[model samples]
Target: MANFNEDGLKKKLDDLNMSQQSIQTVSLWLIHHKKHAHTVVNVWYRELITATDSRKLTFMYLANDVIQNSKKKGPEYNKEFGSKLGKVFEHLGALRLDEKSLRGLNRLLNVWEDRSVFDADHIKLFKKNLNKGHGKSKENNSRKRELGGKHDNPQSKKRRDSASDAIQPSTPESRLRRDSEGDLTQFAVSPQSSTPPSDPPEPEQLIEAIQELENAATSDALVREKIANLPDEVSDVNLLNKLQDLAAGRALCDQVEEALSMLEAYNKRLAEEMEARKAVARMLHDYIAFQKDLLAQAEETLEEHRQKQGKVKKVREELKAHLQNLPDISKLPSIRMGGLAPLPSAGDLFT
Candidate 1:
């Protein structure tokens, strides 16, 4: 990725196109360096102002992609772009846009309004300014056409119209129009993976699994105690000296065999418990990763809420200040009964 500097950003903008891949690639890079969102937005606006009319819509699309997608990760891009979008709309609106360009711009505005990407008031103001600019441009074009028509010879005008019609079929703008229309269609359909995402493990299930591992080796306390207190005679041959007869020896042999069987059973249980522990370890690792992702998402949401609260607070304060500065309505002079001139009588009017 290129460094998030003004020069690097300008270079990227220069290469930007209407293709979904191009816009998304640039959006991802911008979102990655969201800490520099302020600089990025400034650079974007400056470049957009200088960009040709054909490229202006592409810049808007890039901004839209970044603002919408970056919200899940952080609000930096949205905040920065939100502040500058009004001016962006005004600039684009002032240009002589074709039908397709105007339609594309309207579509973008509708999407933002529907998504509530910005406050309703802001969106309304943006749309108003955009229309105002376009209206001004239309008026100017209308005046120019009227002025030109006054001096245009009928034969010359006909020839010029014919020439325009002949050349229109081969114009680059026509090709761009087709390509951009396709690109816009593609952009509208958000990309998704063919495979659906797997859900995280349930908290209850995870807790139960962990709890089961607590006594996985042996849940039988008595058996565990008995194993711990096993006699040494089971493994010691020297104890045979204490045997007084064949019956005693046989009894010792029986005790040793029982001990051996118990130890073997315990060993097998321990091996199974170890395997269970390994599986639980893997599960815990995945669960922890999933939890961290959730935590990050939550933090992003919290930041977005804080930004919204701050905006509302600021607006409220401004309104309060504006109200305070207004003159009191009650202190203004009031009209008295004789303040107005008397009306003429109906009889006088009839006479």
Candidate 2:
């Protein structure tokens, strides 16, 4: 509140080494990103920044200011750095910006510093920055919780001790990471006790854990298994009727059609196999009948040839006997020479 508000900040920036052009440049940049500029240091901005807890961006801002004010070696170091410039960095550090947050602050710091800062003393300077205020409220608010539970600071010894107990020692190592600005920061220090009481769980997480335990305690394994198998984001019992109706519509039809298509494909394959089997059977039957006919014809022809052979042999024997009993050969030949005998051609056998 004393040295850091929008007007204070703007005035501080205005007094710096003003190259005539930089004044316009900085003004235009501020106007264009005015909201962002404000948010960087706005106390009201903490409302959006904080979670459900009323705790402002206390630790986070505090951390950032410390790192930036420390301004040792990282940023541009040629120009002299200043107290107001240091204050702006401190304000940001108070909001918990760490080494990671104010990376751009280095170059910007060079453009604004009145003196040079060192890299070796970065950690020490940061701790000093935390001791300074950033125009934000800094009061302990946990007395009500540990003591008489009121909106106001309940005057009680036990609550005071509990709140004090939460305060961690600021060491070189611990201080580097912390920005605990108000009340007590959760990640401040490890407790000396062997065991610590765990905080109460959120409603959603507790509900899930209770359901899991109930499932585990069930006697019927099948019921437990079914519950486990339940899909996430299921249709609630409240919407069961709607889901049932949807199933009855196109969804059910799609399932039936898919099943029928599979059955039809199977039937088609079965029919084709039956036709192929029948065709093969017909071909086999015809082939067997043809072979039987061929074998019968061969047997009949062989029998006929046998009979003809017998007749031919008998005729030859009679002719030989006739010749033997006939007159002289020259006389018989002259008598039979009246007609010539005809012969069959050799090519006629294959036909």
Candidate 3:
């Protein structure tokens, strides 16, 4: 089991060729298991078998294969993707150790034998790190020395003073603290202080944050940077380009949905305008010309009837006047009328 896990882990470490800090996550998990548990002396285990959730395992398990060296020495392109992979180390560093993690480690060690996925170089790298133990002891020691000891530690003097102060009478157990002046176990790191360093950040935190930063960078950093910096006016244009590519991808169904919504809105407006134009066309065809023709015919008929009626009415009125004047004329028969205008046309009478 140990061999199986080792082989796969080793391959990843070599492939990334990342800094020891990057691969150090898996190493740390292993060391935690190595020091604390009934660690098998032999082969490592399969990664899948031991993990309750593949995602959780992958979260802590996958190593950043891309070395953080200069771009020239490292991957030539897509540095963001490379960096994203490196972020896993930071995430692993952030995780708080617990019993569940121990189970994962046990599973990891149990399956390392049969699955020899790693090449020789990666396997060698793994051994180097694993054999070195967790970097804590060395780093802690360095810190202590840098404080005051000849070592790189920064707290040696204070630690020594505390040791002197805690001294008790010649009780059997008290003798250890009294005799062993620099016993770290007796140094009484607070329950809170027993935690890893806060300033440098844990390897897990580094992995998680770095991964997120890198994830935000995306697969193609070149195009991505442009999209990020695009002017507000051209922002939609950038999105349109992405939507076009996403359509090709077909996997980003959300883009398709958004495009569909825009198209639907356009279609709705077009349909409304088409209905309005159709109503206008109907108004022209049904009402305007019909009313004008009807009015014109009515005007001509009324004019013709009015002229004929007026002629008849004029003749009748003149006849009535003549009748009334006949008696008057009788009294004055000397008034002659032989040259009067003729009005005896038969066609003018009401037939």
Best by TM-score: 1
lDDT against the true structure, per candidate, is 0.66, 0.37, 0.36
Residues 73-135, candidate 1: write the lDDT tens digits.
668888888889888888876778775566556656655765687889997887777777566
User: Any runs in candidate 3 off by more than 4 Å, and if so which?
Assistant: 1-256, 328-351
Model 3 earns a TM-score of 0.22
Q: Kindly list the per-residue Cα lDDT of model 2 for residues 199-245, writing each as its tens digit.
A: 12234544454454442323346544654554332424443355456
lDDT of 1 at 190: 31
Among all candidates shown, the one with the greatest lDDT: 1
RMSD of 3: 48.8
Regarding lDDT, does 2 or 3 come out ahead?
Answer: 2
User: Model 3: per-residue lDDT, tens digit, 1-351?
Assistant: 122255655353333212222333333333323322122112222332233332344333332111111122223222333333223223333444343342332222222211232334543443333323344443333333323324424465554443322211123343344223343323221212111111122345444544544333134455446445544433254454554555454644555565556556655655665665554455444333434443554476578679999999999999999988676644553424654556668887856
Provide the global lDDT of candidate 2 against the true structure.
Answer: 0.37
Q: After TM-score superposition, what is the CA distance of residue 34 in candidate 3 from its true location, in Å?
A: 99
What is the descending TM-score order?
A: 1, 3, 2
What is the overall TM-score of model 1 with all chains considered together?
0.42
Q: RMSD, each candidate, Å?
A: 20.4, 50.0, 48.8
